[model samples]
Target: MNSADGAAVVVGVDGSEPATRAVLLAAREAVRRNRPLRVVHGFIWPLLGVPVAAPAGAPPHAGLRHQAEQLVADAVNAAQAQESGLRITGEIIDGEAAAVLIGESPTAALIVLGDRGLGGFASLVIGSVALQVTAYAECPVLVARGTARDTGPVVAGVDGSALSRAAVEFAAEAASCRGAPLRVVYARPGGRAAQAGEEERLLAESVAGIAERWPDVPITREAVHARPVAALTEASRDAQLVVVGRQGRGELSGLLLGSVSQGILHRSACPVAVVRTPG
Candidate 1:
């Protein structure tokens, strides 16, 4: 299915165990959003090398195409098994994985990916595709990691910027959907009591209307005088999901991701959702 038809929860699969986890999570998200689940596999090797003719009159690049198609089929079947009756589709695109997923972002409700893939090193904190898509995707991107059964608060990093406000709204909706609490965290360098009080006020202002929209979800606010990354990382230990903006007020406007966001993606103990500021 083409993304133009409707917004879907798009997932990238590579026949890895982590990819299976991603498909399962994406399936649940599609059901939650009332959207279809589209499983995509990027076939870059065929573009990099000349196609070779196969035996028995098979088309050139038949083996590679077959493998890619099977990868997509397996992902679709796994997702359907996770949630019976879920609408799911599969496709094999010819491009780099990150580029293909980013190209699909505009029409996707959300892009879900595994934290690491087969090509990723065990020593690496996160995969390159996960990092790139989280930084560049216009829509929110979720990097699936850790256990999915964590029944904790939906933690969000708030800094009173437009992007932070957007993240707060997203977190509120996520908390409402998951039947969990919303924790808004504001972290700043060591400061005076007056500064701490001012930050608290700003945090309250940022989340003012969210409670009205999600009255059933419990909301808690915390203003911590510490590094943003440290505060957010500590909060993520008990969080079911951590939400943050791609860039914040402290970051340069042109940068794709700020230091705090990059740090959280690398260190967060649970699944992290990166939301970009709406134009």
Candidate 2:
């Protein structure tokens, strides 16, 4: 199913620091979109058949279920603190983290996640749940990472594909919400002058519709003569968010996410949103 109109912004929390950060970011997005915020925590103990209830003499709140409930409560509280007026709800689902979030995606306005979680490997830039959800979620997935800057342009990477066009649309809306400028970036390897002109044309076409839709949103274009990942990552250094398509041009059609988008998710110095264009 696709995300319906007026869907909520759903965020999965594991009580990890990264998850906590995601809650704040999600709350902000919920306020910006004027949508409700749904905080979810995946409860695996019940699914694993582990006795979730407390021992015979223990208190009800001492059970695994209680702990899961408490986690969701905490996340909800955090989101509320971020924005008092935001409508918030919490849920504890019996499933894996990634699966639960993916299940929520079809009806979510957006899915917000953290770069890493408690289960994250120190060597890995992003957690398994974050990567998995980003690749499979039906809606845009925003991985809150690096510095959550309050001031910076909304950067979007385009490859002149339908998916990239979706990214531009999403980015334009984000920029308008923040009253920030939208920077459209196109990265190509060759530095040939002839290619520069083509790259400029592609960037212009990518933002044409979005620019018209968000006329109040100032738009700028950048043609980078570098690898897609490197160029976007560099552009993200001072950006509030870097938006990219689930898959880009020249990528294998079978791949759920393009290499450029994946790389930005890992290396971006700001939040990254991967837009999965709807059919």
Candidate 2 worst ten-residue window by lDDT = 246-255
List all candidate RMSDs to the true structure.
3.3, 2.4
Candidate 1 wrong stretches, greater than 4 Å: 1-5, 52-62, 191-196, 248-254
Deviation in Å, model 1, residue 101 alpha carbon: 0.4
Q: Candidate 1 residues 96-179, lDDT tens each? A: 999999999988889999999888478887899888889889889988877665389999998888889989988998888788
Q: Give lDDT per model, in order.
A: 0.85, 0.89
| Per-residue accuracy of model 2 over 1-279 as CA lDDT, tens digit each | 223366999999999999999999999988888888999998888888899988899999989988888989999998898799999999999999999999998889999999999883699899999998999988899999888987999999999888899899999999998999999998888755654368778887898777668889999998888889999989999999999997532345777878888899989999999998876
* Predicted structure 1: lDDT: 0.85
Model 1 CA RMSD to the hidden true structure, in angstroms: 3.3
